[model samples]
Target: MSTVVETILSNHPQAKRDSLIPILQEVQEMEGFISREAIASIGKHLNLPTSKIYGVATFYNQFRFQNVGKYHVMVCRGTACHVKGSAKVLEAVKRELKIEPGTTSRDGLFSLEIVACMGACGLAPVISINGEFHAGVEPDKIKGILNAYRRKESENVK
Candidate 1:
C-alpha cells in the first residue's frame, strides 16, 4: 500500500494543490478507499495539514472514506427515474440489502449509492451493480437481482 502511494506521489513530483483531487482519485482506485495512511502521506507530499486534506476530500461526494462492497449498487434518482417510481426501487434495494446509501452491508456483499443521474433516463428506474445496468427495474425485481448476485458470489466461493 505504501509503495502504491509512493508511486502515485512520485508521478506528481510538484504536488500542487490542484493535484490533491487527482491523487485521491488514483489512490482510491488502487486501494478501494482512502486510508488514514494515504491521507498522511498526501499531506506530507503537499506540505499541507491532514485536516486540510480531509476537509477537501469530505467536501466532494465522489470520495469514499470506507471500502466499498463487492457489489457496489448505484441507483439513479434523476427526474425521469423518480417519475418512474425509483423511490420504491431504492427502498426495495435498501430493504433487500439491509443497508442505506453510502454504507456497505454487514456481510460485505452490497453497498448502496444514490446518484443524481446515470444518463439513461429512457431506461428510467435503473440500478447498476458494478456498472452492469439493470434498467426499467421495479420493486419486485430487486430481490431477484440481488439474489442472482448473491448466488453468483456463493458459487465463486465454492
Candidate 2:
C-alpha cells in the first residue's frame, strides 16, 4: 500500500500544499481508498502535517479512509427519496449492515454511503449497490438485498 503511495508521491516531487487534493485524488483513484500511511507519505512529500492532510481528505466527501467493500451501498437522501421514506431506508441499511454511512461492514463486503441525490427521482427512495440501482426501496427489503450480495460473494468463494 505504501509502495503505491510512494510511487504516486514521486510524480509530484515539486508539489506544494495546493497540490493536496490532486495528490489525494490520485491516491484514492489508484488505491480505492487512502490509508494512514498514504496520508503520512503525502504529508512528508508535501511538507505538510498528517493532521492537515487528513483534515483535507475528510473535508471532501469523495475521499474515504477505509478500504471500500466489494459492494458500495449508496442510499439516496434527495428530496424526492427523503419524502418517500429514505431516512427509514437509511436506518434499515445501518441496522442490517451493522455499520453506518462512511463505514465498511466488519465482513468487508459492504460500505454504506448516503448521497444527496442519484437522479432517480422517478423511482424515489432508491439505493444503488455497486452502481446498480434498486428503486422503491423498502426498509423490510434491505436485508434481502444485502443478503443477496453476501450470497453472491459466498458462491464466488466456493
Candidate 3:
C-alpha cells in the first residue's frame, strides 16, 4: 500500500503480473535495495504469489536483498585486467574497505564486487565507483581513490 508500490503497479497494470522482477529492479535502483515488505506488497499488487516473487529475486545476481552502501565499487577481473595486476588492486580495496566482495561496509559507505569485465580492457585493471570508471589503476592509487570517495561522502554529510 506504499506510494512506491502503488505507483509501480499503476504504471504497469497491463503488464504480465508475473513480471515482478523488472519492477523490483526499478525499485531497488531507486531505493538502493528491496525490502521484504516491498516484495510482499509488490506480490499483492500483482496478485502473484510471494514465493514466486522471492524465487525470481534470488535467481538473479543483479538483485540485492540487503541494503547497499552509498558507494558501490566494482573491480574488473577480466583477462586483461588480471594480466595487469587486477588481483592486487582487488586486495588493496578489500584491505581498505575491510569487507569481501558482495558485501557493504558496516557504515554503509561502500560495497565491493568483483565483475567479470567492465568492457574497458584497453584500460586494464579498472575499477568503477558508483558507475564512475577509473582506468589504468595501480595498487598505490587504490587507497587514494577510496579516500577521495570517503572525503566526498563526508562533505555531503556536512
Candidate 4:
C-alpha cells in the first residue's frame, strides 16, 4: 500500500469498520481526490463492498475520482455571467492554463472547472479559487490571478 493510503487507513481505523463515505470524504479533502486503488483499499480496510464505496463516491459531486491540481479554479457559466462575457473570461483562463475545463495542468499546479451558477449575478463573470470568489472579472485578469496562486505555492515550497 502507498504511504498515503496506509496513513489514511491507519488514521481512521474505526472509520474502516463503519461509515466509509465520510471517511472517504475526509481522505479526498486531504488528497484532493480518490483513486480506484483508494476505493479498493478503503473497502478492504472497512470490510465493505467496493461497489458500494464506488456508488457513494459517484453519488456525491463533491467527491472526485480523478486527480486534481494544487489549485482548483471554477468559472461561472450562468446566464448572468454569460451575458457579461464569461465565455471570454473562460477562454482567457484556458489559454493561460493551457488546459480545458475539467482538466489539470501537466505540472498539476491548476485545474479548471465550469459551473452553471455561483449565485453572484450582480458580480457576473465571476471566478472562484478554492471557493474564494473573485467577482466582475475580466479576461485580462486571469493571468495575474493564476500568477498569484503560483506565487503563493512557490512561497510555501521554500
Candidate 5:
C-alpha cells in the first residue's frame, strides 16, 4: 500500500464504519485525489466493498477521482456570469489550455473545473487559478493569462 493510504487507513479501525467519510477526506487531502488504489486499500481496511466506497464518494461532489495539476483553474458559469458571456470565456480557456472542464492538461500544469457560482456577480466573467481570481475575463485575455502561468512554471525550473 502507498504510504498515504497505509497511514490514513491505520487511523480508522475496521469497526468504525462512520469514519469512512473522514478517512476518504484525509486521503484526498494528502494525495490530492482519491485514487483507485486508495479505494481498494480503504475497502480492504474497512471490510467494505470497493463499490460501496465508490458509491459514497460519488454521492458527494467534493471528492475528486483524478489528481489535480499544479494550477487548478475554476471558471464561474453562474447565471450572472453566463449572461455576461462566461461561455465564451470558458471556450477561450479550453482553447488556451487544450483541456476540458474536470480534466488536466497533458503536461500536468493545469486542470479545469466549472463552478456554478463564485458569488462574484460584480465580476461577471471571472476565472480563478489556484484561488487567484481574474475578474472581467474576456476571451482575448485567456492566452495571456495562460502564458503567464507557463512562464512562471518555466522560471521555477530555472
Candidate 6:
C-alpha cells in the first residue's frame, strides 16, 4: 500500500464512486497525465473495471494521455483569434512542428495545444510558448519563432 496509487488512495481511504474524479485529478497532478499504470492501480483500489475508469476519464477533456514537450505551444482559436486568421497560424505551426494538437513532437522539442482563448483578444492570432505570449502572430512568422526556440533549446542542451 506504499505505491503512488496507494498514497493517492490513502487520501480518500473511504472513497466511493464519487471519489473517482478527485483521485484522477491527484494522479494527473502527480504524474502530469492519467497514465495506464494509474488507471490500473485505481481500478484495483476501487474494485472497478479499468474500462469503467477509462470511460469516465475519456468523457472529460481535463485528462491528458501524454506529457507535454519542453516548449508547450498553446494556439488561440477563439472567436477573436479566428477572425484574425488564427487558422492559418495554426496550419503554419502544424507544418513547422509536424505534430498535431494534443501531441508532442518526436524529438521532444515541442507540443501543440489548441486553446479557445488566452484572455488577450486584442492580441488575437497569438501563440504562447512556455507561458510567454507572442502577439499578433501571422503564418509567415511561424518559422522564425520556431527556429528561435530550436536555437535556444540546442544552446540549453550544450
Name the candidate that leads on TM-score: 2
In order of appearance, the predictions have TM-scores of 0.83, 0.91, 0.72, 0.63, 0.80, 0.86
- Candidate 6's residue-wise lDDT over 17-117, tens digit each? 78899999998888777778888888887889999999998888677767788899999999999999999999999999999887789987898989988
lDDT of each: 0.92, 0.91, 0.86, 0.86, 0.90, 0.89
For candidate 1, which ten residues in a row score worst on lDDT? Answer: 58-67
How displaced is residue 71 in candidate 2, in Å?
1.3
Per-residue CA lDDT of model 3 for 41-70, tens digit only, reads: 888778888888878887876777667788
**Better by lDDT, candidate 4 or 1:** 1
Candidate 5 C-alpha RMSD relative to the actual structure: 2.5
- What is the clash count for each candidate, in the order shown? 0, 0, 0, 0, 0, 0
> Which residue pairs show backbone clashes in model 5?
none
Pairs of residues at least 3 apart in sequence or in different chains that clash in candidate 4: none
Q: Whose TM-score is higher: candidate 1's or candidate 2's?
A: 2
**TM-score ranking of the models:** 2, 6, 1, 5, 3, 4
- Measured on C-alpha atoms, candidate 5 has an lDDT of 0.90
Candidate 5 runs further than 4 Å off: 15-19
Output the worst ten-in-a-row residue range by lDDT, candidate 5.
Answer: 10-19
Which ranges in model 6 have alpha carbons more than 4 Å from their true place? 1-3
Model 3 lDDT at residue 28: 82
Compared with the true structure, what per-residue lDDT tens digits does model 1 show for residues 1-158?
48999999999998788899999999999988788999999999999899999999889877777779999999999999999999999999999999878778888889888999999999999999999999999999999999999999999999
Candidate 6 clashing pairs, residues 3+ apart or interchain: none
Best by lDDT: 1
Better of 2 and 3 by lDDT: 2
lDDT of 5 by residue, 64-141 (tens): 787888999999999999999999999999988898777788788999988999999998899999999999999999
